[model samples]
Target: MMHQMRAETGPDGATDSVVSWHIVRNADLTALCGKTLSTAAPVQDATRWTLDPDRNCHTCGALFLREAPYFPDEHTD
Candidate 1:
């Protein structure tokens, strides 16, 4: 199956649930749903970060679900 590039990046902190996470396109800092953010936005690896449904961007999450984003380093064993 084809997958869309998704980068789960947000503020650098241990507080993952409260911070409004934005699903940006892989290699791009902008949100997948087109919500513009500052260039100084803290972007980190998806696998290394966490998210909360209630605090995340719904549009981006919906887009991500529809596209079924993939991570290259993730193994399916």
Candidate 2:
């Protein structure tokens, strides 16, 4: 099966606020591609809990809304 380009963001009230996904084609080119292309869904842009796993700093372990965003990297932008 061919996988179409898709993007999804964390649900509302979700502890994880990080945006995920990759850009497939530009908006102008998406139509020409003949495939349903999607972009990263934007959240409320509020401070939400995020956690990084010990294995990888780029990975999120867990997140608790209203708690704290924790990461093994010790820093985040």
Q: Which ranges in model 1 have alpha carbons more than 4 Å from their true place?
A: 1-19, 47-50, 69-77
- In the range 1-77, model 1's lDDT, one tens digit per residue, is 32222333346533332355666665565677786655555555444333345656677767776666554556576
lDDT of each: 0.53, 0.28
Q: Worst lDDT window (10 residues) for model 2? A: 57-66
Give per-candidate clash totals. 0, 0
On a 0 to 100 scale, what is the lDDT of residue 14 in model 2? 28
What are the per-residue Cα lDDT tens digits for candidate 2 across 29-69? 13222333234443221222222222211212121211233
Q: Name the 10 consecutive residues with the lowest summed lDDT in model 1.
A: 1-10
Pairs clashing within candidate 1: none
Candidate 2: where are CA atoms >4 Å away?
Answer: 1-7, 13-16, 28-77
Score every model by TM-score. Answer: 0.52, 0.21
- C-alpha lDDT (0 to 100) for residue 46 of candidate 2: 20
